[model samples]
Every structure is written in structure tokens, then in C-alpha cells.
Target chain A: MTHTEAGRYLRLVVAEEAPRTGDTPDSGARRVWEIAFGLAARRRFETDSPLAEIGRTVTAAVRSAALPLLEAEMLVREALGEQVPVDGIAESVRTAVHLLVFARLADELALTDDELDSLIAQAEELAAAGISPRSEPTGVP
Target chain B: MGQTGTLYTAAGRLLLDALGEKSPARSLSHCAGSPGAVRLLRELFTVAVRRGFVGRDPRDITAYVRDLLDYQSLPAGGEFARQAEAVMRSVLGEPEVAYAVSDRRRFELICLMVGDLVRPPGVPTGELVALMRQAERRAARS
Candidate 1:
């Protein structure tokens, strides 16, 4: 349920289900990014126009080491279904997705409690500073 | 994952690769429209279901569906939405009344249809599944 836990789950599932070298090639991280950005967009802007609020969260995620700025922006654009060119951001996007969407997908996939905890210990090691990739704007406005 | 599920995953991957090679457009959307393509897809699904690839594991089915949708680039709500619906009704044999379901169900059916397109003839079902499981186990460690 935590960010690190989410990251690990994303890593495992992507590795298992979306292996890098395959015919149906994919970037698991990109898929993760789409889910997170998509969820955040839906929550904040479902009723009124909150593009600024969404943009700020996105800008901050990009500003942080959690995700690259342009990649995060393009992901937001893609989640909105824009057909923009997002070349060279796949790796960065995947890392961000690893940080953001794991917990959310756990619920959607009905993962078991044990499965949810599968990589928590390893994930905790990655975020010793306690900062996660949730779009909460760590130090930027 | 069970041996059966793992095997199906592997077979599914091979079928997906084969589809890309054989199809004119390298997409299920194109294949769905052609009568010849539909027959080929039906055969693939028959082989998979008979071998217990799907229907046994929801997770397996879910993963397969996601991959198919992504690979085929078929949006849940897009130009091909109606095509997906038709495929579901014909393939799953849902009652005519069930045709008016939500977009989400239609999307799920489309994913199912796409996943079923990876049909390889003459290969022993048990052998294919076993081979995929072995490959999966090795891949997990690497």
C-alpha cells in the first residue's frame, strides 16, 4: 500500500507480465505512469476544471527525482489521450510508474495480502528517506 | 503461477508474435474484419480453452487481455468500440439483450477476442504449455 511497496509490485509484475525483451514489447513503467497520472487527473478534475492543480502535482513529480519533467508532462498528456510525440522518455516514465501506480493496481487486480507485501522489504530499502513518488509536490509549488 | 497458467502465457506470447507476422496490418482490429481471420482466431481460442489456458485462472486471463489491448492499440472507447462489441456477441454468444452492456464489458470482450487470435495449429497443447512454463521460470531468475 505504501509507495515503496507499490514500486516493488510494479517492478515484479512488469518483469513477469511485461518482460522487456519480447514480441509484444512494452515499457511497464510507462503503463504505471499512465495509471497514476490517470488516477490523479480523475480525482482532482472530475467535476470542476483543476488543470492548474493537476499541472502542479505533475510539475512537482517531474521536479523531484521521482520522475523527469517532460516525461511526466507527456504522460499526463497521453493519459488525457493526446497524440503528442513522447520520444526518449519511456525509461523515465516507467520508473515514475513504478513509484506511483503499484498500490492502486493491487486493488484493481485483487492481489492477495501476502502478494501485496511481496516486495515491501526490498522497496523500503530504496526509499530510506521516506519520500515516495506520490504527486504531492515535495518542495515545489 | 500454476504450470497451466504459465504455459498459456508463453503460448499466448508466441501466438501474438505470429499474428504480428501474418496479419497485413499487424493488429487484431484488421484481423477481426476478415472472415478468414475470424476462422483462424476461433481455432486458436479453441485450442487454448481445450488446453485449460483460460477459464481456470482469472489473473492469467486478465494479464492476457491487458497485453492484447495494449499491443493492438485498441482503446476502450474509440473508433473500434462497436467492432469489439460485435466480436464479443458473436464469439461469446451473449444473448442479443446482452449487447447493450457498458463500455467496460465491451472492452473486456475485445481483449478476449484479441488474446484468442494467437492460435498455432498442430502443436501439442501440453507440450506448448510445458515449454512456456520452463521458459518463464528461467526468465524470472534472470
Candidate 2:
């Protein structure tokens, strides 16, 4: 419905769920990111394959990269244990992490292990080839 | 008998419930924070799940957004914007779908109903179907 109504509903749901665990921030971050990653995967690349091990691999990158940037990663663990309520602080943290990493790793399927091994080669040919990133814009004129 | 535990241990139902449970609050402030920014959007999705509006296809939503944007020749960021814009225009023209759902669930309902139009990815051929068949046989054994 309206933006505020949804927020109200979210608070109620979050209230019912157990708060996040205090221990193991790493797992907590990992779990919440998993949902954001799922949303991004569904909406971004249009592929469900992102739900598999490869998705997990990509998630591992986003989560580990973001853990250092977050302060409440541990306090938020229990909140993360539930599906991240739309209103929870963990939801924002998780999505912010996904946005940062997804911007870099967007065309993930195009990246191969072999290419990653040789950074200089890939970096040099970044624009020359296999969809590194969108240099030229589209849709908006 | 074997079907009882199918989605039982899985987080899918939990995720689905979260999607269904709450709608985000609205505010005029410029920043409700990061989760705040997407809170409304996530509620829309949860409603979608509750209504069975979303497809069972496993692609995560972000990746779907990326691919759909790329395909539409729209800037990736513009993808959701475009959809939101289009839906607005459609409602202005027709206005029927809104009546079918509660106001709080509208956005999520849209995502559920139309999110699949973003186009699904190629399947890994018969790989999964074969696996399912084998698993079914195993389940039948006991």
C-alpha cells in the first residue's frame, strides 16, 4: 500500500520475531545478506541460479567485504535469524552491502576463475571484451 | 507422507512469512536510512509471496533486476524506476488491480504478479529434473 503503512506492518512483525543473537556476527551478517542477495538476484540478473552455490560464493564476497564496515554485525545477529523485517536496521545494513558489491560484481557469470587469476590481463582488457561492466549508459536519454 | 517435510526445514517459508508479515512505515524525511529506503519495497515483495504472486523460479531478485534492465536497454538503476513509472501510468489508465488487494500490500502484490515478466534465466537442462527423479525413488524406497 502506502510507504508508511508497510513500515507500520513491518514493525509489528519484527516485534514478534526473536531478536538477533549476540554471538557470531559473521553468521548473522551472512544470513541477512543472503536475503538481500536473493532479492538482488531475482531482480537483477533474472536468474534463479544465483540461489545456488555460486550465489553463495558471490554472497560470501559481499558479506566478508562488508563485515568490517558494520558496527552492530553481532548485535544484529538475532534479528538476522528471522527473515530480515523490512523495518529492521539489519535490513539496511544487508542491502547497503549488496549494493556496494553488486555494483562491482554485477556481471558475475561472465567472470571465470581463470580470468581472476590474471588480474593484469583482465584489467587491461576490461573494456575490450567479456562484459566487465557497462561503460556506456542505456535507457535514459 | 514424504511430502510433509518438503518445505519444512527450509528457510523459504520463513522468508515468505517475512515478506508477508509487515509493510514499512512512511515518512517525509529525506533519509529513513538504508533499510528504510528499501523497506517499502521489501514489504511489497512479502505481500507478493503471500499471494503466490511470485514464481518458484530460483533466481534471486537482484540478479533478475540486473538482467531485465540489461535486456530492456534501460539503465540498471532505471529498471525499478521504469517499472514503478509504468505501473503508475497503467493504474492511471485502468485502475482495476488496486481494488483487488489491500492498500498496504499493493506494492508487494505488484512485484509478486509481475516480477516474473523480467524474464527467467536458462535452466541447466535436465540436470535438476533427473536429480529429482532419483530423489523421489529414494524417498519411495522406505
B27-119: candidate 2 lDDT, tens digit per residue:
211112333323433433334333331343222232344454455554544324224322332333223212323443445324433333223
Model 2, TM vs. native = 0.24
User: How close is chain B to the truth by TM-score, in each candidate?
Assistant: 0.33, 0.22
Off by over 4 Å in 2: A1-48, A52-54, A67-119, A127-141, B1-48, B53-55, B58-142
In TM-score terms, which candidate is top?
1
Return the top candidate by DockQ: 2
Q: Give the whole-model CA lDDT for all candidates, comma-separated.
A: 0.42, 0.33
Error of 2 at A73 (Å): 20
lDDT of each residue in A17-132, candidate 1, tens digit only: 53344333244334433454354444434322343444455554444444543344334544444442344455645455434444333443455656545444333442453433
Fnat score for model 2 = 0.06
Deviation (Å) of B49 in candidate 2: 2.6
Clashing pairs in 1: A29-A94
Which lDDT tens digits does candidate 2 get at residues A1-141?
221222222222223332333543343334333333333333334221222343343444455444322112211221222111122335455544543443333344343434322322322234234332322222212
